[model samples]
Target: MQRATVERVRVAWTRSTLDDRRAAGRALIRELTAELVPGADLRIEQRCPGCGGPHGRPMLPHAPVLASVAYAGPWAVVAVGSDRDVAALGIDAEQERAAPDLAALFPLTSPPDLRGWTAIEAALKADGRGLLLSPDQVRLSPDGRATVPDGGEFRILPVATAPGLIVTLALRHPDPGPRPTRRP
Candidate 1:
């Protein structure tokens, strides 16, 4: 797969057991690195920073570091960055079957409701901002579009492997063009 452009967003999915899930995630990370940074050897592993839980983030033994990881349930996803750009990416995966309390975890009171909630969480993480805004402050449209609380552009893409998992990527940068003038 080609490297995703700053304006483009991509999501990849694979089915596997818990162990296989982690392996698949690592493989994806390698592939991404190859696509993003050609001729560079990359290796990814899960290590605990004395936190008991496995840390899914990747680390490059050599210099020029860039990568991030997010794993939920039996799925793991990684994003690799470029030299001039910081990698702002997020991934989420969930079981295809309905869980007993999934609704409670992610309440879907109405249609188009669930994607927004998921997008907000993903966007915040992607921008390195977490829980900065309340759930009600952000809104998601019926067509998978999301409006950031502070007028930022956010892109949301649903993961393919799992029905309940949704991944969102948000990019915020200074406006370089001339500002639009409004007439009353």
Candidate 2:
């Protein structure tokens, strides 16, 4: 079988509401799963990191592939990867604005450049803690690499996006496979 790579969204998700976008995103993921990894069972799971609620990062729990979804206005993006290759992965999209203010939002770390900020955000998302994880704890060097504290190292890259949109992709290498779950 040919090696699979992360699949990015081609068409924009035109849903007006979050609920609609989420459902549509999952459907797209299901289709992408069939095309990307043939014969693999795809089950999308979303459990909040802070709480055990069902509104968290969309992922394939216990499955060999990792997935993440992000939205910006009317656009929704999904990213999928094989757990054999990606320990963790994240993708994010933000609409570009003039002189955006993020320092007030990201107190621990605020990158001067918009692309850098998106890169940092992608790494944080890959770390799985998202905003809960302080940006200061993330280590991003001159290279397009970031090491998350107590998490996997990630490679952040810019993804081609539509006009007025800034999209970033983060992929954590050397996935150690699924952790053993207690029978509790």
Candidate 3:
């Protein structure tokens, strides 16, 4: 976990339970990084767009690995990928719940269901823009493909994990090659 992340979590005035949950989620990212790159020092860069703060996308500075973390309710997912395999990778886990009012408010981009929403979010994250772009900018097709801004595209794979928990992995395709299909 980054020091800035730790400090932000510490200073937040949320409930102790919430703090623990957030801390655990951050710890999961650290644990995954350690396991993925054993015996190597890992540094995460969270460069905010405006102020270069710790609220930006997580970047592996010294390695070619890319990672993203998302936490919703009691679920958190950490996804990592090598540059050779994917230009960028994102994963999101969401709990199944009904929020009918939200649909009407964001009609144009609101997904028909939670899985679709997760897929779009994962694609946005994989694009390295996150919510910086409106949902309308990241159109999710019925075929689990996403048309991201900047002419990029992503392939989304959704999986049902524990009950009520949906996980989606989005991969931004690297440049075409003879073995483009191969992944690490």
lDDT of each: 0.52, 0.70, 0.64
Q: Which ten residues in a row have the lowest lDDT in candidate 3?
A: 6-15
Off-target runs (Cα >4 Å) in candidate 2 are 1-19, 98-100, 106-110, 175-184
Worst 10 residues of 1 by lDDT: 1-10
What is candidate 3's TM-score against the reference? 0.75
List model 1 lDDT by residue over 103-150, tens digit each: 444355532344454566666555444444444445666665566666
Best by TM-score: 2
Q: Write the per-residue lDDT of candidate 2 for residues 14-132, one digit (tens) a residue.
A: 34466577776787666667665787677888899898898778876645677777777666777776666667778777778643577776676555477777777788888888978
State residue 63's C-alpha deviation in candidate 1, in Å.
7.6
Tens digits of per-residue lDDT, candidate 3, 71-147, equal 66655556666666667677766767732334643566544467777777888888877777776667777787888
lDDT of 3 at 169: 78
**TM-scores for all predictions:** 0.55, 0.77, 0.75
